[model samples]
Target: MDKIQHRTIFVNGINMHVAEAGAGPAVLFLHGFPELWYSWRHQMLALSSRGYRAIAPDLRGYGDTDAPPSSASYSAVHIVGDLVALLDALGLDRIFLVGHDWGAVIAWYLCLLRPDRIRALVNMSVVFHPRNPSRKPLESLRAAFGHDYYICRFQEPGEAEEEFARAGTARIIAKFLTSRRPGPLCVPKEVGFGGSPHTQIVLPSWLSEEDINYYATKFDQKGFTGGLNYYRAIDLTWELTAPWTGMQIKVPVKFIVGDEDLTYTTPGIKEYIHGGGFKRNVPFLQELVVMEGVGHFLNQEKPEETSAHIYDFIQRF
Candidate 1:
């Protein structure tokens, strides 16, 4: 891990923290919620050893990066703008993009907003949610999953943060990182973000105590507000992304998801992926792999397979 290089570069009006290694073709990684560039540590080292320059950023609101106070600042446009400027600052014209969870959402938007800058993409966990012109994202999620749903529960400001604080930062991080349930995560007002406090959580083999400490120490300093703000801006991103309605993700792509991943088990998601909808939208999609028994944090849970999957796909382009 000490072999990885860290630097903060000014981009898009904010100071962005980036971790990079190797000296060949660039591969840019985008991490999801409750995570930082540190989440991509294994991939950075693995891919770098394979002669690919791997770059992962702390993004705008996580880790050492600047977190703006306004929810408006966390929109897709703002996050993508930060990345576009980061690429220019690094003197790169194009890169192989990879993302997981919310990072995957941003990857889709990046492809939509700046396809020219991406050589290819390997997105995990979340699929491209084509914009629905008739409804806002929060409204749709509420109607489909109700107020207790995690995303819906996150809509209100400070409520989730208070719950996280009550749960304790390290415990909360452990719960999210070790969770293996395939069902949609619902944090009811009564249950809160940490779920039942009496319920014990067992750390999985893939995640070590040290790993939790690394993430917890950062979340401890930065607080959950910076990360939760991403969920807060979903509807606003929907409204701002109207121009991308019905647009196809034109880049060559590969998508992989754990069969037990929450997004995979969401209602109708199987149909969407296997029933021609996904292919129709992402015309250039090269492959889709569903790893059995793996959960939401696929990369962390199965680092070797995940890194190999990324290396195999990106090397083709």
Candidate 2:
């Protein structure tokens, strides 16, 4: 293991633990759910070797960061604001942003809310599925998917938090990190995309023995409350995003997803991506690339390819 120096910084009234290495152009790496700054271990070293200040942080409430107790504190607005304050704290004016899963959600919001502070954007495994202001309630979405939808289960207060807590973080992490081999070319009917429930499944290939333990240890320390707060804010997210309902991200944007990823296969998915909100909001968008034979955890599954695509995109600007 290459030893990397770690530090603690205060942002948005919370103490954030960040792992940093290399030095050059700024590339802020943000991890998704149940993951820590360690999620970008490879990318941080790779980019650092190539003259980039690669920084990854355990976003508020996930790792060493302070986990606020209220769901209201976890809004996308607040998350993005934290990122802004992070930059301010570091005295950085602009940066190349990279995020996955829930981190991608915050990345999208950050780019929208403060484009001037971001030099470029790269998202993996998650798409910019804007909040549907008039879409059916999360309950209706859950009822539609049933046991197949884990997200809807998450939306219900206390139920998911309690269930995941009882099951333990290791179980929850295993469920999402399932295998990537394209099996049957089918999307489970129960897990709807864009804030729908996810069917329980086995862990994916990307997670090795050490990876699992790493995540489990963090969950052991943080519990799932802070991470769950992101999901709990669905309704609040909708209400907050109402102001930017028609706002498209004008920054140079790129969305990457695995072909085997359940996200791209949801019914009416393409319409959602290419029509209405997306088209109107992202004016200077880049292409969406789908990697075959890969699952949702692309960075871990295929680091060389992920890094290549990201560097290529950043070089263009």
Q: Report the number of the highest-lDDT candidate.
A: 1
- Residue 279 of model 1: what lDDT? 96
lDDT accuracy of residue 253 in candidate 1: 96
Worst 10 residues of 2 by lDDT: 188-197
Candidate 2: which stretches are off by over 4 Å?
Answer: 1-3, 135-148, 179-205, 274-280
Top TM-score model: 1
Question: Which lDDT tens digits does candidate 1 get at residues 238-301?
Answer: 9898888999999999999999999999899999999999999999999999999999999998
- What stretches of model 1 exceed 4 Å from their correct place? none
* Model 1 C-alpha lDDT versus the unseen true structure: 0.92
Tens-digit lDDT string for candidate 2 (1-317): 36567888999899888888888788998898768888888888888877788889899878888899888899888888788888899889999999998888889899888989988899876667655666634655565656445565566566666666655566667655664433222224343221122445545455676787888888888788788888788667778778887677878888788877666655565566666545556666777778887777788788878888888888666
**All candidates' lDDT scores?**
0.92, 0.76
C-alpha RMSD in Å of predicted model 2 compared with the true structure: 4.6
Each candidate structure's TM-score, on Cα atoms with residue i matched to residue i, is 0.99, 0.86
Error of model 1, residue 188, in angstroms: 1.2
